[model samples]
Target: MIHLTLIIVDFLTGLLAAGAWALASAGGAIAALVGSGFVGFSLFRKWRRRQ
Candidate 1:
C-alpha cells in the first residue's frame, strides 16, 4: 500500500513539473512575439517621420 502511495505521489509531482514547463514555454513565446512587435512599430514610426 505504501509503495502504491509513493508511486502516485511521484506521478503527481512529475505532472506538475511538466505543466509548469509548458506554461513557461508558452509565456516565453508570447513575450518574444510582443517584444518583436513593439520593436517593429517603433522602427516603422521612425521611418514614417522621415517621409
Candidate 2:
C-alpha cells in the first residue's frame, strides 16, 4: 500500500510539472508572436511613409 501511494504521488507531481512547463512555453511563444507583429507593423508604416 505504501509503495502504491508513493508511485501515485510521483506520477501526479510529474504531471503537474509538465503542465507548468507547457504553459510557460506557450506564453513565451505568444509573447514572441505579438512582439514580432508589432515590429513588422512599425516597419511597414515607416516604409509606407518613405514611399
Candidate 3:
C-alpha cells in the first residue's frame, strides 16, 4: 500500500544518491591523477635541463 510505495521511493533515492557520490569520487580521482602527472613531468623536465 502507501507504506510500501514510500519504502520503494526511499530505496530508489538512496541508490541514486550513492551513484552520484561514486561518480563524484571517480571524477576527483581522475583529476588528482592528471594533476600529479603534470607536476611530475614539469619537475623532470626542469631537472633534465639542469643536467
- Strongest candidate by TM-score: 1
User: Candidate 2 residues 1-51, lDDT tens each?
Assistant: 999999999999999999999999999999999999999999999999999
RMSD of 3: 0.8
lDDT (0 to 1) per candidate: 1.00, 1.00, 1.00
Per-residue lDDT for 1-51 in model 1, tens only? 999999999999999999999999999999999999999999999999999
lDDT (10s digit) by residue, model 3, range 1-47? 99999999999999999999999999999999999999999999999
Tell me how candidate 3 scores on lDDT. Answer: 1.00
Candidate 1, which ten residues in sequence have the lowest lDDT sum?
1-10
Badly placed stretches (over 4 Å) of model 1 are none
Which 10-residue span in candidate 3 carries the lowest summed lDDT?
1-10
* lDDT score, candidate 1, position 8: 100
Looking at candidate 2, the ten consecutive residues that score lowest on lDDT are 1-10
Please, what is the TM-score per model? Answer: 0.97, 0.87, 0.90
The alpha-carbon lDDT assigned to residue 31 of candidate 3 equals 100
The CA lDDT at 6 in model 2 is 100
RMSD of each: 0.4, 0.9, 0.8
